[model samples]
Target chain A: MSIVRLLIGGATPRALALLAALLAFLVAAPAFLGPYALSVAILILYFAFVGQAWNIMMGFAGQLSLGHALYAGLGGYIAAGLFFHYGIGPWVGAFVAVAVAVLAGCIVGYLGFRFSLAGVYFALLTIAFSEFTRIAFDHWTWAGGSGGLFLKVQGGVTDILNLRGGATLFYYAILILAVGAFVLCRLLLESRLGRYWLAIREDAEAAQAVGVPVFRCKMIAIAISAALTALAGVWNAFYYNNLFPETAFAMGRSIEITLAPIIGGLGTLFGPIVGAVVLTGMGELFTDLTEHLKISGLKQIFYGLALLVIVIWRPAGVWPWLAKRLGVEERGR
Target chain B: MSGARLEIEALGKRFRGLRAVHDVSFAVPAGAIHALIGPNGAGKTTIFNMIAGVFPPDAGAVRLDGRPISGLRPDLVCAAGVGRTFQIVKPFKGLSVLENVTVGALHRHADLETARERAGAILDALELGDRRHQLAEALTLPDRKRLEVARALATEPTLLLLDEVMAGLRPTEVDRMVTFLRDLNARTGITVLLIEHVMRAVMALAAHVVVVSSGEKIAEGTPAEIARHQAVLDVYLGDAAGDAA
Candidate 1:
């Protein structure tokens, strides 16, 4: 009966009960956790939200974007830029960020779809755009150029209203965003457009022959994905209270955002969320191990090994394998 | 019934130096079951592609119901009352059988539930109702072909273009498909333009037959007339046509 469950590929009663338990655990988590643990939890949720956004493009729509950081970087700059120059809060600038990101998506989608750039070419184009933005932002004086944009923290107390606060507010913000994204994606995957996307992903020619507006549907996918990614970017900028084009729009950042969904599962609704939790959770564990041993870069090595193992053992992702083990069947997903 | 539901005028297509289809013209009257027959690389599928707007012909025009459909995108062609099944049976393998059909149903019925219900009916009509929830990839070759036809039928097209719908079927399955195609045309009054190599199906169902060879329409007539055509014997059947006679 819950809206979230209804939105999530029409979750069965058992799935609903499980989801309720998970939600309860997440809600009560902050109460018992210390600041460090809370931050880790927030980071996990943050990645989960972004992962969901990326999943819309690659997972559902089957457009492999390797430079998703383009959206996030652009969104961050817009929000941060507005706040720095016009004294507009990120809350208000979020709209501008979305608009800009959608516009960028349209341009990229137009060029890519128009020229029929697909597969590795599409991925390269996305990376090229992100790289271009990185270079442009590096030279732009209004956003502190290469020096990076830093938001001045007032006093020391948490500023919940302005989003310049402690990690707790961000945790809740990201939690809400992740929930919203999940519901939205669920609704999308069940809709007519989603069906068209699935068809297009399977065979574009056959889809077009069946009256699906293939190019338009793909553009919509890209635009929606960019908008969602931009929202996450805006949040990332405000939460970190700083922006550097190098780190913000880095290709590595895009890869990081996409790694979880790929490792977890490609098209399933909960793949990204589950993947983020596992990935971030393992990352933290690896960092702890490295710290105890006084070694650096162990986390990176662990990530590579994890990815290799997942690719070898569970190519369809952890979610599909886990779902099979759990006897959960979602139709047409 | 009425005149031609689909008209191709001087249709020609080229892939670099190779002429896939050249000045190929044909017409399928409304409510008629038409067959386009040719040997391998004779441009039968190429003509279908042109009519279905897979790509614009280098020269010529396609009109459906007196409306210009040439140079239109494939989806636009479909929207203009054309539905097609691929020669290779390109089913949405990841989706369930019902979902695969539902994608076409969504063209006319925008509501997902209505489209789903319509897709269900189409699957039932195609004798695939029991496997509606099964993934398309899990189906046998015959079932995959059936799913392809089912998906095309769900679009409610005035003209249905089937590219070798009976290519790999067993003899019994081929007979069943022939019966189904005839029944479909009789029931829905939908025009059928099919490319087929099955001589029995061609003789049994096609109201008219057009033969192409080397990217050109070599002959067009009733099935019996095509059977006697000298060029069809020379180019298509070779010694087989002589043996039949």
Candidate 2:
């Protein structure tokens, strides 16, 4: 039985079949693609994973965090640092990375929700925290300061446990992660907790009148989201073989994390993946085109135009509209 | 099984310098349909807010079945067996009608399937079963009002607070709501504390009536007694006369 059909929500059987086929195609993708193309596929899966992490916070719970790169960056530094300085494996270090990321999310969620900072104010608070981390990490010499941190790839042995393997190994690992994120999000969406999240997202005061615990539910959203985002950070460190404080905690990177879900469909189960595919595919295509044409900055302008067009064309996003056209749309979504 | 299902004594609130509610007290008996009636801005809703824990009073105490509930957060107040409806009737716009009520029902069942079943039952009882899958924001005003009441009832509350659930309702719709509420109270033995200005529904549904005027409790008795009370009459007819003059 396909995992799509096993999901608790009542997706149309046609939709399930379509999803299963897409997964099969992705699983077989490396056979048909070159090294460079395989790398782009890896980028899509990464964005899909991280985008869902951000979606659970802003999309499902409606608590916007504009500085989500902090979680990823912090997780990467912790895991990579442990692996580099101490000879611990990335698998073991991932635990510590996830815990730290959860702690950071909790602190930010607590201060924001407790003090009634909402919407743009909460977003600004997140940006401030990320900015603070960036500046602090730039001066911290122990972790290589702004110059960056490098993972010492072991000389001869290809240790899969340590996450030192070929590109295909990393590709399969990320595929499992993206699929896992989708399943987990579906499970959470089908639970009683998900109902409370929707209520809080729509009208928090109304939710409280009928017994939904707004504060605690929001906190849980952030914690789970941070934990998943941290795992993505761990993957990034090992795959890239290096991390720079400037690139890891960059404000531009933080904004990019939100682009996928917003363009695909916020709060929908498949929005993040769909958003990831379109945005990353278009972004890479534009970058390649601009490079070939000897033009420098057309990539960003194209991205901005795509975002503008999508927002103006379908504010609710491409997935909802596409689902409707495909005859697989859920009611009341 | 007890004295008052809900009680507030000397309940007072102030908005900066202005006293919104002061020296007001009342007790609602178990299984009774009670009404708090007043003209617009008479602080009836203010008293409701204090009881439902939207805000604490400047000075007073609120009790449910003889246990203090004042100063609890709104969600905690609900967990303490109180459920409330807002005058504005803002349902979760992204959620279906069933999902909106299921959020409240989960308070009792603590799971998705049972909560959804309970919400379905409440929707059927409230004649919203047909529109169960519709987005809450898509409902008509009367339907939205009914959705507010339905959602509150799904919580399995011992005491329900209703703030103008019948406001903006047509006469026939109001009558239907009154009948449904009266039947609900009689069948379930759930206590109801309603803030309303719809006198006809008040007379039909409420066994006990409390009237407030300018943030002060002016009268309290059976509906018949309150209709005949001079102070209640002055607050209503006197205000009308002043309006005319």
DockQ of 1: 0.85
The numbered model that scores best in DockQ is: 1
Write candidate 2's Cα lDDT for A1-333 as tens digits: 245443735777798788879999999999998999999899999999999999999989999999898999999999999988998888999999999999999999999999989999999999999889999999988778999999876655577888997788889989999999988988787777877888889998999888888999999999999999999999999999898989999999899899889998999878888899899899988998899988889988988898899999999989898888888885453
TM-score per prediction, in order, is 0.96, 0.96
Once fitted onto the true fold, the runs of candidate 1 whose alpha carbons sit more than 4 angstroms away are: A1-9, B1-4, B237-245
Individual DockQ of the candidates? 0.85, 0.80
Q: lDDT of each structure?
A: 0.88, 0.89
Model 2 stretches with alpha carbons more than 4 Å out: A1-9, A153-157, A331-333, B1-4, B239-245
Query: Model 1, range A1-333, lDDT digits (tens) per residue?
Result: 345444754567777787889899888888999999998899888888889999888888789999899999889889988988888888889999999999998999899989999889999999999999899999999988889999877656776656787777788888999988987888888788988888888888789999999889999999999999999998999888899989998989999999878878888877887788889988888989889988888878987897799889998888888877766655554
